[model samples]
Each structure stands twice: as C-alpha cells, then as structure tokens.
Target: MPAALLKYALSRKYPARHAFTRRRDLKKRYDVVIIGAGGHGVAIAYYLSKYHGIKDIAILDKGYVGGGNTARNTAVIRSNYLTEEGVRFYRESVEMFQGLSNELGFNIMFENRGQLTLAHSDAAIRSFRWRAEVNQHMGVRSELVDRKTIAELVPNLNLSEDSRFPILAGLWHADGGTARHDAVAWGYASGACERGAELHQCTEVTGIETKCGRIAAVNTNRGRIECGIAVQAVAGMSSIVADMAGIRLPIHSFPLQAMVTQPYKPLLGPLVSSPHVHVYIQQTSRGEFVIGGGSDPYALYNTRSTLEMKETLSAAILELFPFLGQARVLRQWAGITDMTPDYSPIMGESPVEHYYLDAGWGTWGFKATPISGKTMAELIATGRTPDIIKPFELERFYRFQQINEAGATAASH
Candidate 1:
C-alpha cells in the first residue's frame, strides 16, 4: 500500500474519538492556556485538572488534537538509559506508561515487549556494558547478552562471521515497549475535558502579547485569549513558539522517518536496534514490521519522506534480517522532531514570567507524553519545578549543567 493509504487504513482501524470537536466561546480569563494540543498538551491539561485542582484551562492548537507529533511518532517506550538521571526519570516514565491504559480508562495498548540493541563492535559492547550496569543500578530491567544469547533471542538475525556490523552481543531491555499513539492523546483529552478543560482546535496563535515581562494574552486566529499561564507543547514548532515568547531555546529541528512492511508472521519478537547501523526494527501486534533509523545527517524542518532514507534503512534492515528481503514496504512517513543539545527535553520554566515550556521532544518525546505532562502540570499548578525535571531546565545550557543522553538515547529512543 502507499504511505497515505496505509496511514489512512491504520487510522481508520484505530480511529481517534476524542478529537477537539466541540467549539466553545473563548473564556475571557483562563487560569491556563496551553498551545499545541499534542499528547504533551492534553496530558498537561488532564494532570492540571485531576492532580492540581485547576479546572479552568484551555488547550489551543493550530490543527486538530493529537494531530502533530502525537500521531506521527513510532511509539517506543523504555528507560534503559546509561545515565543515572536519565535512567531514573525515564524509569518513572516507563512505570507510568505501563499502567497508562488502565489509568486513563481507555485502551492505549501499552505493550512491554522486550527490546534488544545489538552491539556490532568491541566499542559498542563496552558502551552496552556500561549502560546495562547503570540501568541495573537505577532499577531498570536491562542486561548485557552474549552472542549465544543473541542467537537464542533472535534466531533469524544475521550473526555470521562475514556479516557487516556483525552482531557481537546485545543490550537486552526487558522493560522497553510501545503504545498506541492516538489513544494516549484521546485518553488525556477525554479525561481532561471531563474535568472541565476546554479544547479549541483550528486555532492559530500568531503572537504572544506581554506587558511588564509577564504574559497578558495570546493573539490567535480565532481571537485574543486572556490567560495567566501559557505552555508550548507543539513538538515540531517548539523553537518557533518559544521565539514568539522572546525566548531563545537551544533546540534544533530534525526530521525522523519510519516505515512499515506488509503484514507477516511474527518473525521478530522484540524491538531490535544497532547503534553502528543507526536502525531499529520491531513487529507490531497487527503483524507489520516497523523500521526506523536516526535522522538524516543534515538538519531539516521538512516532514517529507525520501527515497534515500528508505534505501539506507532498508539496506540496514536486510543486513540484519536477510530473510525478509522479499517483503515489500507498506508505507513510509516522516515527522519533525525538536532536539535539544543534550538529546534530553528542556521542560519547566523559561526566563519569561507565566510562560512555561514542554518542548524539545526530539524523536523520543512521544513515549514521554505522560511523564512530561505530569511534571509540567506540577510546575504550572504548584509554581515549583519538580526535582526530577529541574535538571532539564532551559537555563541549564547557560549554567553548563547539561544532561547529555545522546550516546544512550541514540539506539534505544
């Protein structure tokens, strides 16, 4: 199938019911006004109402709810990181995601299938060992597996001596998994709306009106929204939105591409990846094999897919699993990711008063929707940044207190 047709089919099979369909008169003064109705934005709205007792909230988006990165993500969730803070924070995120379906009273299809990241070189093995040790210390279910173990784990993978980027070992993360992307947004939207939060779609914010360095109102296509607090959870346009608030975030935009193969029997059991090859593959419950790699070497804001990425990623896929060479691809799509310097998101406060941030998600932000929303909610409602998210503040760049997860996030996220 073509990418659009396949996407339309998949979306129809799992349609989003909680889209922002109700048009309401803009409240003159909302306690909070969140921009970008993605997963992060909806999750924030839900947490604000449920946890913080703040009910008067408005979530504004330029497009439909959950139609941004929330719908475009590959949906991998895990916490087997190499850093203590990274492992700790993402471990919490994993736990939240594990029970997210039940918690949201909706079926998000959170799957805790194990993930295996292959190590093709001695250097890769060393990095895996370090990551496994750190993850274990942080109470994550990650371990180093040898070549024999790799053969048992994924019998069809090419581990022969003559293979390129030969599989020497793997970092097995038993806690890594995936979820239904749209369901997360719906759950949050439904729960938040039930708690009295208003959602407005087809609303474009053209300017951020401020006075005395404090947010006064937001000028939008619909009208000016008078608000007390504002958050930008718009994934691809994080920097653009932040710029509107006169904040210079250290975030860069890059396009990540992923594709699905025609349905086949469950040949791959766990999510498999390679840092050397910069590729990851896993079969979905519906039987399609999802394939993705890192971003193109160049930075781009485009969401258009390319034949070059498809050829390169397919080559890597065949290199790992040559048996699937005949299987045709069903679709290919691209999403713009907001990446920060550390490969970790910059959440919490900005320099501007009453302006908060939940930006810089990159390729890994979709899995972090619940956690980011919870943390940002706490910050906005309580007026204090949680310790878990304090290290990822926007001022970290200037303060030289960075949380670099590039090495660990590369293969796994």
Candidate 2:
C-alpha cells in the first residue's frame, strides 16, 4: 500500500466529501424544474446538462437525495419482460446499466450475475416460455431452462420433487443483474451538479401555477420559482404531485416490503425469484441476503413493514433454499410504489401542456432509471417525445391502450 493510503487508513478521523452541492437559495427561474431528487430525477438532470447542454435545471426533493424509493428498492436490473414495448425499453436500460459506472465516473458496484425465475406449475411454465420468446425476439438473452439446467446453474436451489411447488422449469436471463441503489442516484446527482444543475434537498413542492394551459411557476415550501418546464419524477407520490398541477393520474400507491439477513458465508449466486410463491431472493455482495415480494394486497401510502409480510417472505425463501432456515434476519423495511393499472410506467406528455409526467413506475422504477432519464431529457430538451417512450404516454390510459405487464411483474420486482 502507498504511504499516504496507509496514513489515511490509520487516521482516527477520516474526512468526508459531499457528492452533491448544497444550495441554500432557490433561483428565481430555471429552464427546467424537476420534482424528486431520486435516481430518475438526477439522471434526467445529468442527461439534460451533459447531452443537450441544458444546465439551467433545478431538482427539488422533499427529503435528502435518493432517500425515497430509490434507496429502498432491491436494485435488480433485468430485461426479460413480456410485452414488446416493455422488453425493448428494459433491454436498453440493461445495456445502459452495464456502462453506467464508467459513464458516471463512479463505482456503482454493478454485477451481471444473471437472474433465474423459477416455474412451479404448468401455467408458470407457459408464461415463462412466452416471456422467453418475447425476450429472445428483442435480442435479450432469455430462455426457458429445464430442471437439469436449473440445477447446474443454481446448485443450492431446492430441487425436491415432493415439495409443495415442484421446480418444473425456469426463465434464465443472462442480461439480468444488480447494482448499488443509492450509489446510482448519488453518481447521477454528482455528475449533474458538476455540469451546473442545482439540487435542492428538503425542498418541497407545494403547488404548481399555470398560465394559458401551460406551466408558469412552481410553489415550494421555500418559495415559488418560475420555469419553462416541470417534470414530476416522484415515485410513490406521483398522484399527489400531479394533483397539485390540477392533473389527475390513474395511479394507486401500495407499500412493498423487503428484509435483509445478517451477513453469512456467500452461498448464493444469481438472483432467484418464484412468482408461484410470490417472493424473490438475492444475496448481496456484502453476504446479506435480500428477500422481497409483490406489493401489499391493498393500496395505501404508508411505508410500514408488516410481520405477515416478513413471515410470508421467510417461508417462501425457505421453500426455494431450505438451507437458509438457519440464517438470521437483521432488518426489514418498506417503500411506497405508485402502481398503474397496466403495471407499466406512464411517461412523456400529460394532460397539462409543458408539464411532463414520469409517474406510475411501480416496482420496476430503479431498473429503468438510466433509460427513463435519457429519454425524458430528450423529450424535455427538444419539446418532442422520443419514439422509444411514446408508447408509455399518459394518453394510452385515455385511449384504453394499456401495455399490460401484470404477468411479467408478479413477484419478480
């Protein structure tokens, strides 16, 4: 080790460097005002400043950066979706995630460990087959695998035929992986701030003022600031924020719970999920296993973890990896997800002119952070929606053209 490194490592107190700038004053005007300072919001600002040369941006968050759903998600990145639109969109996101660390000049700790979705019944087998075909047609590395291949891929998985839900087949997605959730948000915020975009933490958006059917200014707890464009990227609070703009969105908020086990010997590889049991499991690089499942059965805005969810997740994970029964759980938490009827995100133009929407991400928001940011930046900068994201516009709900992905998003989130 270098002498300076040794000295720093041995120091009693280490210096801390702030990734994003701290601004106390809000500007009177900006080219764009983005609500929510999570991964999507910061990524949008980063792309706007770096790609389109639009640096007059303001990112306002009610709390600290990346403190919402961005910090709460499990960080699974995959492209093996069912619908054509969903598959294509997430495929690009997977590709972007591969190079995100280098592009942002930050270590996001991205690992392409692949993902395995287990099938326990004939219906699940058929669904996996369909999704595999759709994914393959879109150039994503996804295929249906038999029990033999699954055993080779995940030697530790329970393959007992006498189990309640026998392992019939699986969907092996080689393009799937995971990354550090908060690091991604921090990287984008740092990059965007370096390029002159301002981030205001603890700045709450109170309401929005419009003039002639266009956005005029945004009212915050701090003060009101005029902007040419306003974009809402608040994940769980999408409907509430859109309501402030006098626009109603078709969204329902639900709490998704997850838990982490105490660090143990690394015994799991590849992300494992089973929709039949409604649970997913992945061991983090730190040796702690993350376990999560579908959203709560009811719709609510609170982020409270429940004992029932913990018991359900624990039981489901044991069904797939029986050896983990000895592992001790360290903590559990929850996040609010803004779900749409179709289980697909609503992007692009909204009913309010000059007020773009980036809402209804549900459980798949973190995986699409980069692509959503890039495409939304393009739309905001050029005043034209990109072709890649037009299919996800809010108009789809009005036209009854929902890109249904309920089957694809079941417990895989």
Candidate 3:
C-alpha cells in the first residue's frame, strides 16, 4: 500500500484516541442535528464541521455508528449508469473517493479494481452501448468489451455456449471499485468528532417537532433535542421521518438481501456482475465471497432474509460459476432500502422549511455517501441546493422527471 493510503486507513480505526466521550443531556441545543449515523449521516456531519465551519452538530443513530446498511452492503462502488445525470454525479463521487482518505485524513481502503457488467443478451449489449456512450460523454472511463476481453478480466469465468445467461460481452468501468464501508463511516465520524461534532449512538429519533411550518426540534428515545436544522440521512426510515414532518416523498421500502460464502483463497480480482443473471460476487479482504443481487419482487420494509431470496440469488451465482455451487453460504442478511420511483435519491428541501431530506437512496445509498455529504453540506450551509443535486429534488415527482438507473443498479448494488 502507498504510504499515504496506509496513513489514511490507520486513522479510520474506530474510537480514535482523544475522541470525545458521549454526553447525555436535553438542555444542550445543536446548530444542526442529523439522523442516522451511517456513512451518509457521518459524512454529512464531517463536511458540515470541516468545510462549512458548523462544528456544533450532532449525529444521532438508533445503534452504533455504521451498524445499519453501512455494514451490510457488498461495498461495490461504480459510475457506469446509462443516464447522463447518473454518470456525471457518480463520476464526481468516484473522483472524490480517489483522494477521500487524504482529504479526511483517514484510510477509506478504496480499491479501484475495475468492474465488469456482463451482457448475455443482444438487448443487454445494446444497453451497454448506451451506457458506455453516456458515461464517455461525461468523461467517465467506460466501454463495451468483447468476450475475449471479459475472458482476460476473469479467466476463471465460465462462459460456456450452452450455459444459462452466457456471457457474450461486458461493460467495463475502469474507475469503478469497492471500499471498506465501515471504515468510511468511521473515518467520517472520527474526523467530524475531532472537529467537535457530537456522535450519539443508541439514539432513536421518534418524532420531528415542528411549529409554524418549521422544524423546532427532534424527539428521540434519549430525549428532546432542540436544533436549528435537521437532515434525515436515514436510508430505510426515510419515509417514516418525512411523514412525521408532513413531507410526503415518493419512496417505497424494500429489503435488499445479500449472502456470503466461507473463506477461500483470492480467486476473483475485478468485481464481476451479470445484469442478465442479476447476481454479483466479490472476494473480500477476509476471503469471504460477498454475494448480492436485485431487490425482491415485492415491496417490504422488513430486514429479515428470506428463503426465496437466498435460493434465487444462489441459483444465479451458481449459473455464473458452476464450481461455486458447492461453496457453503456462511450467512445471509437483509437491509431495508428506501427506493424512489426514479431509482435515484430525493435530496434538498422538504415541506418543512428547516428540515432537509437526503433520502430515497434505495440500494445505491452507500456509494453516494461522500458526494451526498458534500452536496448536503453546501445545501444546508448556503440555504441552496447545488445544481448537481437540484434535479433530484422531491418536486421532480410532480414534473414526472425521474432518473431511473434500475438496470445498472440491479446487478451490482
């Protein structure tokens, strides 16, 4: 590892020395209070304190920091969407991720090992062209590759002619990759706390107190917290929070499930996915084969893993690599995702004047943590949403303008 990368990773270690111990009191008021201490909330707090000079902030979570979807995801990060806005926004995120460790003075353990989305059908190939063109137009490094290229990327890949969803081509995203999800949340939280932001775990937000159409304070399980501003970065509970403030966002809850196999020698390098198969697998640093796929057929808020999901996901995984059929699944888990109709985020102002929303992330929320923090910080501090995030406003539902990246999001997320 590079010296800078090593240094960055070391700083992200949890409960950094000199970190502030938790404080308990309802009398203290914060300038800003963000809900959900996952990667998004932590990053938001970090940017608010580090960039906007708003250090009197508090991040409250129902559990420990990053104990939510931040720890459950497969950690795939990419920007190879088939839409213009999606590509540009995520490309900016990818660029930020490159030096994020340095900027935050913590090691995020970002690995740009590239990502290949296999195409099994002519239609999948066509979609790849559109995605490649759109990504390239936005200055992103994405392109269509032939079977030979795919073979080189994953020599052990099974591309038999008669196999189900046989790989014919692929969309190669050169800049796409993965990161240590926990490290990201910890890095942001550690840095933010170092800058004087308060991180409170085991703090459950139960209600949003508003008066005269503006947020007055937050009612939590711990107690009442008076705040000047509140940003809800909670992924699954986004709708519940918005409803408390009488702000109806177009978001539906669904459970995204993933399973991992027992440890094995490093057999995979670049992240591989088959949109046609709807399954993705990557070997972690600990040698677990982290496996994940699309959302369930039904909309659900439950985070419990289902037998149907495991069977379906496993079938797809085996179809891609028959040799892995015997690999035992060590564990299966699920996380609730707040999926917007557009398959993108719904950020910016809500019905309540003092409440800002950074929700509707669906399964792709983890990848956008840093960018969302940067953008949301600017939005809250300047009282204006940046152009990049304006298109994702809640009002877009009325305009019927949706940025759906479902195709790209399904296989990899």
Q: Which regions of candidate 2 deviate over 4 angstroms?
A: 1-18
lDDT of 2 by residue, 213-256 (tens): 99999999999999999999999999999999999998999999
- Of the pair 1 and 3, which is ahead by lDDT? 1
User: What TM-score goes with each of the models?
Assistant: 0.94, 0.96, 0.94
Model with the higher TM-score, candidate 2 or 3: 2
What digit string (tens of lDDT, one per residue) describes model 1 on residues 288-371? 999999976777888899999999999988999998799999999988988888898898888889899898898889878888
lDDT: worst 10-residue window of model 2: 15-24
Off by over 4 Å in 3: 1-21
**Candidate number with greatest lDDT:** 2
Please give the lDDT score at residue 286 for candidate 3.
82
Taken over the whole model, the C-alpha lDDT of each candidate is 0.88, 0.94, 0.87
Residue pairs clashing in model 1 are none
Residue pairs in candidate 3 whose N, alpha carbon or C atoms collide under 3 angstroms: 8-106, 8-107, 9-107
Kindly report which residue pairs in candidate 2 clash with one another: none
Model 3 lDDT tens row, 28-51: 689899998999999998898999
lDDT of 1 at 55: 89
